[model samples]
Target chain A: DVKVTQSSRYLVKRTGEKVFLECVQDMDHENMFWYRQDPGLGLRLIYFSYDVKMKEKGDIPEGYSVSREKKERFSLILESASTNQTSMYLCASTTAPTGRNTIYFGEGSWLTVV
Target chain B: AQSVTQPDIHITVSEGASLELRCNYSYGATPYLFWYVQSPGQGLQLLLKYFSGDTLVQGIKGFEAEFKRSQSSFNLRKPSVHWSDAAEYFCAVGEAGGGNKLTFGTGTQLKVEL
Candidate 1:
């Protein structure tokens, strides 16, 4: 079984504060992704990295950025947390870029900005 | 650009009743369809996926989905609903060589009545 681990399960941050959501996967998958999930809107891709040090912006990458320093680790950074940024963040990974491969997700990080 | 739409926002079903969740997608070519379930505060888990071949795909946890090319739809179904089946379900579409980028629908929240 593949394991994608999100470091923080729950967090509460004040407005204008910087926040970091960390994710680590055990399978050493080549592709990693960060997504924001909210009620009604479902899951929107924020950022994804196909290789270490390589990142691409997704549909909703406005206030977020991601870093992939190693193959097993991907991190999502919120430059300035706001009330609207309070939502659930998920990290996912998959082997290479193929339609047949399955993408595995970490539990999730619940961020609350007040 | 590929997109997905889950028409139903919320659905309620009694235990032992049949279940069906709708998912429609828009893509230029043959799309990679997937069904995912998310328990509260948890990440998304793959229920099933359709790449090619058989239109009907069986998944874990007694769930299955069928791909209808004519309708551009991939709907999930379960023979019997259980209390544990109550959760948010998301439908997603991915491009074949699009670097695993997926467009997801605004999930459908399921409520199972005992």
Candidate 2:
């Protein structure tokens, strides 16, 4: 079974504070993604990395950045945490590069930005 | 542009009752459809997926989904609902070669009554 692990399960941060949400996958999948889930809004993509050091913006990428220094790790960075940034963050990974593949998700990290 | 719509926001069913969840999508190319379930505070898990071939696909946990090209819909169904089946169900669609970028629906929160 593939496992995707997030570093933090819950967090609280003040306004304008920087925050980091780390995720790691054991499947060695080539694609990694970051998403934030809010009530009634569902899950919206924040950023995705298809390869190491390569990142792309998703539907909701404002105030968020991502890094993929290694194949197993993808980190989501909140430049300046705000109350609006409080959400349940999820990380996912897939093996397909050209064709479609099933994505596996981490447990998720809960953020509370004040 | 690819998009997914789940008409139902919340659904409640008694244990042992039948279950069905509606999902619709808009995609240009051959659509890859998927149904995912997320427990409270947890990441989403793949319930089933439909890429091609058989319209009806079986997934984990006695869940199945059928794909209808004419209607552009993929609906999930279960023979009988259980208490553990209470969770948020999301419908998603992916492009043919879009790096597995998936567009998810707002999700339907299912509540099972014992």
- Looking at model 1, residue A66 earns an lDDT score of 85
Q: In candidate 1, what are the lDDT values of residues B1-114, reduced to their tens digit?
A: 888999999999999999999999999888999999998878889999998899999999999999999999999999999999999999998888655688889999999999
Q: How well docked is model 1, in DockQ terms? A: 0.71
Clash pairs (backbone) in predicted model 1:
none
Error of 2 at A96 (Å): 1.9
Highest DockQ model number: 1
- Comparing to the true complex, what docking class would candidate 2 get? medium
Instruction: Pick out the ten consecutive residues of candidate 1 chain B with the lowest summed lDDT.
Output: B94-103
After aligning candidate 1 to the native by TM-score, how far in Å is the CA of A6 from where it should be?
A: 0.6
Per-prediction CA RMSD (Å):
1.0, 1.1
- Candidate 2: residue pairs that collide: none
Evaluate candidate 1 and give its CAPRI docking class based on DockQ.
medium
Residue B31, candidate 2: alpha-carbon lDDT: 89
Model 2 stretches with alpha carbons more than 4 Å out: none
lDDT of 1 at B113: 96
Off by over 4 Å in 1: none
